[model samples]
Target: MNSDHYTYRVTWSAEDAEHVGLCAEFPSLSWLAATPAEALAGIRSVVADCVRDMSAHGEPVPVPLADRRYSGEFKVRIPPEQHRRLAIEASEQGVSLNRLVSAKLASGA
Candidate 1:
């Protein structure tokens, strides 16, 4: 199976004294190793095994979040005060609130 469809993250774990690899789709599954590469490899191997087993049992594998389609738009809820502040800032900058917020978000601020 192509393991590229899965999401893997490797992070250091002080408790285990090793890097830990986790798949967001399969929260219960994890792998640990002295190095990030080893941890990732271990997790990939385990994921492959899991996929094969699930396939054999006629269980469905989850679609990875990365593989899902998304619309460019989404909604956010902000407090009335915060919304007022942002509206004032956007006005001061001579831009629509959406334009200001979009610019800020794009800049990762």
Candidate 2:
């Protein structure tokens, strides 16, 4: 990553109410979780273990998260008629419904 460009977010969560844990995932990076806060802190030390036993010789190391930018997910509801119309337009344009909607919105449709 260019350090100026991309960002990823990983919200920590326990496996269950009784457990303590942290969870993290990124689009272009690896995923990991810890049973305790200390386990998460141990990432740097344990990363070497993952690399040492790796089948590939040139594997990269996992670095600590430095940025927290995120495009959070939200729900948008549309009437069935509107959805059908968007789908038909998308099919006519040889694109997916999402692509069509994105294009139309970007074009002030």
For lDDT, the strongest prediction is: 1
For model 1, the superposed segments whose C-alpha errors exceed 4 Å read none
* Candidate whose TM-score is highest: 1
TM-score of predicted structure 2? 0.35
Ten residues in a row with the worst lDDT in model 2?
17-26
lDDT string for model 2 (3-108, tens) is 2222333345455333222223223333355444444444423443444554256655344255544565356799999999989989999999887888787899
lDDT of 1 by residue, 39-108 (tens): 9999999988998898889999877878889987799999999999999999999999999999999999
Off by over 4 Å in 2: 1-68
Q: Output the TM-score of candidate 1.
A: 0.80
Clashing pairs in 2: none
Q: Evaluate residue 77 in candidate 2 and report its C-alpha lDDT on the 0 to 100 scale.
A: 95
